[model samples]
Structure formats: C-alpha cells, structure tokens
Target: MSLVSKFATVGGATLISRIFGFGREMLMASALGVGPVADAFNLAFRFPNLFRRLFAEGAFNAAFIPLFARALEEDGEEGAKRFASEIFSTLFSVLVVLTALAMIFMPALVTTIIAPGLAVCVDDPAAGGNALSCAMRFEITVTFSRIMFPYLACMSLMAMVCGILNAYRRFFAAAAAPTLLNFILIGVISYALWIEADKATIGFLMSWGVLVAGIAQLAMVTLAMRLAGFSVALKRPRWTKGLKRLLVLAGPAALIGGITQINLFVGQAIASFKPGAVSILQYADRPYQLPLGMVGVAIGVVLLPELARSLKAGRLAEAQHTQNRSLEFALFLTVPAAVALFIIPEPIIRVIYERGAFDPSATPAVAAVLGIYALGLPAFVMMKVFSPGYFAREDTKSPMIVTLVSAGINIVLSLVLFPILAEQGIAWATTLSGWLNAVLLFLGLWRKGLWEIDGKLVKRSLLVLVSALLMGGALIAMMWELNAWLQPGDAVTTQIAAIAILVAVAMAIYFALTLLTGAADRTMVMRLVKRKRG
Candidate 1:
C-alpha cells in the first residue's frame, strides 16, 4: 500500500476510536466535572496511563517495530514469530512484577511522586475541613491507582501483540483496539447514569472499567494475531540476540518515552494544587487529542514500519519520499484543526463539554488552555512524523537525548509559568515543550541527512499554513455573523447545528484553498491511489 493508503487504514480506525473517545469524555464531563472525585480519577488514571505510554505503546513500538520488521526481512515468518515470542515472554514477566510493586507502593507513589501537590495541604489542621478533604482525595486517588495499575501490564502485553500485527501489516486490529477502551468506559458511565449513581461510585467504576478494557483490548489483538496464523505462546524466557538488542534499545527509548510522559505528569502535579484544575485540563485535552490520535499516532505507527523496510532494502530515496509525504499529510490535516481550535476554542468547548456537572463558568478557563494547546498541535503531530526517521535506523539514542532536553524545558517552564499563569501556565509549558521537541527532532534528521523537505513538500507546508489561516479568518467572521444563534444559552440543537456548520464550512474553505494553492492535485491523488492498489 502507498503511505497514504496505509495511513488511511490506520487513521480511519483511529478516527472511529477518537469519536467514541469524544463520547466517553462528554459523559465523563457530565458525570465528574471538576469535582473532588474527578480530580482523584484523573490522577489515578494518569498513573497507569503514564506507565502505559512509557512501557507499552511509545517505547515498545519504537524499539520493537524496527527490530521486528528487520527480523522478518532477514529470516522470514518463522524467524519473526520466534523473535516475537521471546520478547513477549520477557515483557510479560517484567510487567507483572512492575505492576505488583506499583500497586503495593501505591500510597507512597501518590504522596511522593504522582500528586505531591495533593498531599501538601492534606495534613495541616490549621487548614481545617479543607485539609481533611484533601487527605481524603489523596486516599481515594491511591485506592483508584491500585485498582487501575494492573492495566499497565495488560496493555503492555497488548502492545506486544499490536507490534506483531503491525509488523505483518495488519493495522486495523491494533488501531481499532483502542475503540474498545472508549466503548467500555462509555457503557460503564452510561449505566451509572441509568442507575443514578453517586459521583464517587462512578469514579470507582471508571477505574475498574479501565482494567476491563485492557483485558478486552488484549483479547481482541490476540485474536487478530491468531487469525494471522501466529501462535504467540509463553515460553521460558532467555536472552536471545534479538531480545538483548531490543532491550538495549528499549532501555533508552523507554526513558525517552517516560520523559515525554513526565511532561504531563509534571503539569498534572502542578494542576493538582488548584482544586479542579486537573479535570479542567483533561476536558480541554480531549478535543485536541482527536486530531493528535487520528493523525499523529496513526502516522507514527505507519511510518516506522514503512521507513524501516525501505531503509533495510537500501531504498534511501523511497524512505525520503515516504517521510516527506507523511509530514505533508500530517500538516495538511493538523494545521487547520489547530487553527480552528485556536480561533474558536471557547465555542467548541462550550458546545462539547459545558453541560450537566461541567459548568458554563468553566468554559473560559478550559478554552484558554485549549487554545494554548492548539499552538503546539502541528508541532506535536510533526514530532511523530519526524521521529520515525531516527527509529527506522534503530537510532533511539538521538531522540532520547533530544527528549531529555525537551523534558528539562518542560519542567523549567512549567515551574516558571505555574505560579504566574496558574492552570494556564501548565498548558503553555506543554505547548512550548512540544515545539522544542519538534525542532530538535527536525534538526537531528536534517543533520543526519535522513530527511529533506524538497521544494514540493516545503511549498505544500506553507500552503497548508496559509490556507488554515484563511479558514480561521473565515470561521471567525461566520461565528460573529451567527453570534445570536451560537450563543451559549441556545438550545442543544442550535449549538450542535452551529458547530456542524462551522466545521463543514471550515473544511470546505481549507480544502478548496489547498487546491487553489497547488498544495493538492486530484491527478496526483488518483495516481497515488492507483499505484497503491497496483
């Protein structure tokens, strides 16, 4: 398949997943809002999600995909299967121990690391009733953390299965697997609402829902593996050459991944100090994640294996072509979405989240954060596009070094901004860090001569930016024109209609502008599609 087709395969499934995630978040906002239980739930969920990104998806895919693809090239299916089995065995054993230790030390982890902000005021009797409530929040966070910690192990195993599927070019199963998580969460929340459960009860059920989703995700991916004719059985673990090499690369990649996640952890820790800040950031976060997941994560998944195979075959030109096009494709979709978010954040947030427990008063704060997040959206997606150039060559060290520096930037700025910007400072810090990471990744690729923009890609990128700006301007004008109808107090149907009109008009303007600017061509698209099928 062409890169576009492959991206569509993965991205299309991810779009479905993101849509369901939207539903899940909408329900969560109505149920949890920025309450005490909401804070605890976000904190508890972040603990396992931190480990999941570090050990399961990001680092694991970085180290595993290139190696697995290389093994398939060198030794065929049988060889690849053996390599996968060994890695799976070792990963399963290690995660089991890790999850156990984390669960046992959940309280210490909560107090010392994850949410030190929550613990700070929890013990002061002078702080009165609020202090006691803070203490209860800490206790609740720890309890939920322990319950959800096992998901890290489950998802780690599932990541291995996903690696197997992606190595074999089976993107649907892996990409679609995340939708199961959204399904489970939405169902659980909906059921809770049906029974008119308390907020705390809903919070507990959501953590348990995570564990259940992990299991369902694993089973779904495992079945995909079996159907693809791979029997990934647990064997006695040994340090095979492939396993050793993956571990060597994975150690640094894991740190790199953890560093990326630590940026969020730091922000959350800071946000934890301000009552509802954690949940507010989360509500703002969900909308932007739709594009990030649909474009950024999908491209990252497809690019790694494609680049790895091309480089392995000494097809440097092909690798460069794929890299440039993927970057262009990423920007083409991401830039306008970012522009739209930046331009009309409050309207979007108000439409999506300002209902039920999610008060209308919270919209301005969340919208401000969302706009800041939009500033980094393209950079965030481009990081995914660029990093594959390094991973395809099995050079995880460079990205690790760049990420460490980026992490420093995040921590320093977050500290500087938090006291000044308060909750918004955390969002600003994340945006700055994202841009820094993207720049470093781009520079690294250029210096190594692994990536080149060429004339067409550069033109297309500029075209995307200009087109997005125009669309943003047009949307602004329209929103102003429709102010009476789009006002916050309008009926739900009116709000939905306003958003739909805005999106449809924005998409039309952007795509039409791209065509007019020569950023896209129907002939080229058709040819690419034909070539992919051929």
Candidate 2:
C-alpha cells in the first residue's frame, strides 16, 4: 500500500478509537470531575500508558518492524510468523515479570514517579496538601494504580504482536485493538457508577475497571493474532542473537521514542500542583490530540514499514520521496489544526466539556494547555514523519540521543517555568520539548545525508497554510457567533447540537478553502479515500 493509503487506514481506525476515548473521558469527567479521585486516576492511568508508549509503541516497534519486514523479504510468511512467535514468547515472559514486580511495589513507584507538585498537595490538603495527594488518600491512588498498571504488560505484549501484524499488512486488527480498551473502560465506569451510586468514590471503581479492561484488551488482540494464524507457547527466557540485536537497536530507540511521552511525565509531575491542574491539562489536550493522533501517529506507523521496505529493496530514491511526501502531508494537516486549536481553544473546550463535574471554571486552564500544546503541533507530527527514517534502518541510537537532548531541555524548562506558568507551564515545557526533538532530528538527518525535500512539495505545503488561514478566519467568526447562541453549563443536548453545527461549519469552510487552494487535488483525494478504507 502507498504511504498515504496506509496512513489513512490506521488513522481512520485510530480516529474512531480517539473519539470513543473522548466519550470515555467525558464519562470520567461526569463521574470523577477534578477531585482527588480524578487526580489519582490521571496519575494512575499514566503509569500503564507511559510504558505502552515506551515499550510497545516506542522501543518494540522501532526494533521489531525493521527486522520483521526483513524476514518477510527473505523467508516470506511462514518464516516471518515464526520470528514473530519467538519474539512474542520472549516479550510475553519479560512483561509478565515486569508487571508482577511493578504491582508488588506500586506505592513506592507511584511516590517516586509523581511530581512534587502533585505528590505534595496529595498528602494533606489541609496543610496545602502534597503534590501527589489524591482526593481519597495517597494510598488509594497507589493501590488503584497497582491494579491497573498490569496493563503495561498486557499492552506491551499486544503492541509487539501488532507490530508483527502490521508487517504482515494486517493494520485493522492491531489498530482496532485499542478501541476495546476505551469501550471496556466506558462500560465498566458506567456500571460501577450505576450500581454504587452512593459511594461513587470514582477512583475505586474506575481503577478496578481499568484492570479488567486491560485483561479483555490483551485477550482481544491475542485472539485476533491467533485468527491471523500466529502461534506461540511459553518458554524459558533466552536471548538469541536476533533478540540481542533488537535490544541494541531498541534501547536507544526506546529512549528516543519515549521522549514525547517522557515530556508528559515531566508535565504531569509539575501539574500535580494547584488542584485540578492535571485533569485540566488532560481535558484540554483531548481536542488538540484528535488531529495529532489521527495524523501524526498514523503517518509514523505507516512510514516505518514503507521506508523499511524501500530500504530493503535498495530503493533509496523511493525512500527519499516517501519521507518528503510524508513530511508535506504532515505539514498540510497538522499546521491548520494547530492554528485552529491555538486560536479557538475555549470555544472547543466549552463545547466538549463544562458540564456535570467539568465546569466553566476549568475552561481557561485546559484552554491554556491546549494553546501551548498547539505551538508544537506541527513539530510533534513531523517528529513522527522524520523518526521513521532511522527506525527503518534499524538505527535507534541517533533518535534516542536526539530525544534525550530534547528531554534534557524539557527538564530544564519545567524547573524554570513551572513556578511561573504554574498549571500551564507544564504545557509550555512539553511544546518546547517537542520542537527541540524535531529540530535535532531534522538537523541530524540532513547532516548525515538521510533526507532531502522537493521544492515543489515545499510550495504545495505552503498552500496548505493559505487555505487553513482563510478557514481560521471563518472559524473565528463562527465561534464568536456561536458563543452568543450557547451557554457553557447548558444541557448536554443543546451543547451537542451547537458543537455539531460549529464543527460542520468549520469543516465546510475548511473543505471549501481546500478546493479553492487546490489542497484536495484529484490524486491526493483519491489517496485519502483509499487510506481511510484501509
């Protein structure tokens, strides 16, 4: 499949996952609000998610895909399946051990990881509370997190197989696996609330739900793999030469790949302060990520296989063309979305949140985070586009180094700005860190003679902005008109209807401008359709 088409397939499925994810969060807001339970839930949730990104999305895929693709090249389907089984068995054992140890020692782990801001206020709210303070109790968050943290192990195993599946061009099952997590959590949370309304102590039920959901998630993906003809069995841990090689590549790649996520940790650590800060940032980030996750992550996943195949086939020119096109496409989609989000965060936030537990007072803090994050939107998307160049070569160290450098910048900025920006400072740190990572990667690639851009593609990328700018003007006007039409704390139906109209108008204007600026060329539109279908 072409890069665009592949991106569309994964991205379309991811878009569904993200939307369901939004619904899940909305339910969470109504159930937990920004209370201690919400804070604990946020921190506890980050534990599994952090590793899901670190091991599954970052390190495992960086190492696994290139080698898996190579096996497919040399040995075809059977050989590739065998290789994946071996990797799966080995990864499964390691994750089991890791999850066991983590659950056993989760309190200290939570204490160690949460920011002083959160942990401090979390302990004693009367005495200004500790940063890690939970609305329930510090132990409550820690205990709940222990139950849920096994998800890292489950998801890691699932992600590794998904990488193998992706190499086999089975994108839907792997991408769709995440939807199970959202749905399961949603159902679990709803039932927990319905049955135990009096002591909704949201954290207790929600945490339990996450653990059950993780199990179901692992089962779903494993079944999908079995149906796809993958086979596996338990075995003693033994590192073969291939596994060793993957370790070498994955170690740095994991570090580099985890930079974006690590930045979040830094932000979260800092955000634990000022009550509701963590939840505020989380909610604001929802809309901002709608485009990023759908486009950025989708492009990155597709680009890895696309470039790895090209490199294996000795098609350097095709690889270069693919890289350039991916970058252009990233710019085309991400830039406009960034502009729109940065300019109109409050309207978007008010539309989606600000009901039940989530109120209007929460809007600015979330909007602040959203706008700050917007500044790095293009860079974050392009980072995905560029990093695949190295992963395809089984070279993870360079990107790892680049990520460390960016992370260093993040740590520094967080300390300097945390006191000043307070809740939003953490958001600023993430934005700065993403751009830093992107810049370093681009410079490294150019210096190493890894990629070059086409002049015409650059011009085409510029046109994306022109139409986006025009659309932005129209959106600004609509948001102003809509503000008068709807109130923040209004009924869910009214808010939903207003948001629907706003999105429809913005999309219509954006689409109209795209046609005018020729952004939707016949070829690109066709490419987008196939991509979505996949």
- Whose lDDT is greatest here? 1
388-433 in candidate 2: lDDT tens per residue?
8889988787888888888988988887888898867888888988
Alpha-carbon RMSD to native, per candidate: 1.9, 2.8
TM-score per model over all chains: 0.97, 0.93
Q: Over 4 Å off in model 2, which ranges?
A: 118-127, 130-135, 196-200, 489-494, 526-534
**Model 2 TM-score relative to the real fold:** 0.93
Clashes of 1: 0
Once fitted onto the true fold, the runs of candidate 1 whose alpha carbons sit more than 4 angstroms away are 125-129, 257-260, 526-534
lDDT of each: 0.87, 0.79
Top model by TM-score, which number? 1
- The lowest-lDDT stretch of 10 consecutive residues in candidate 1 is 123-132
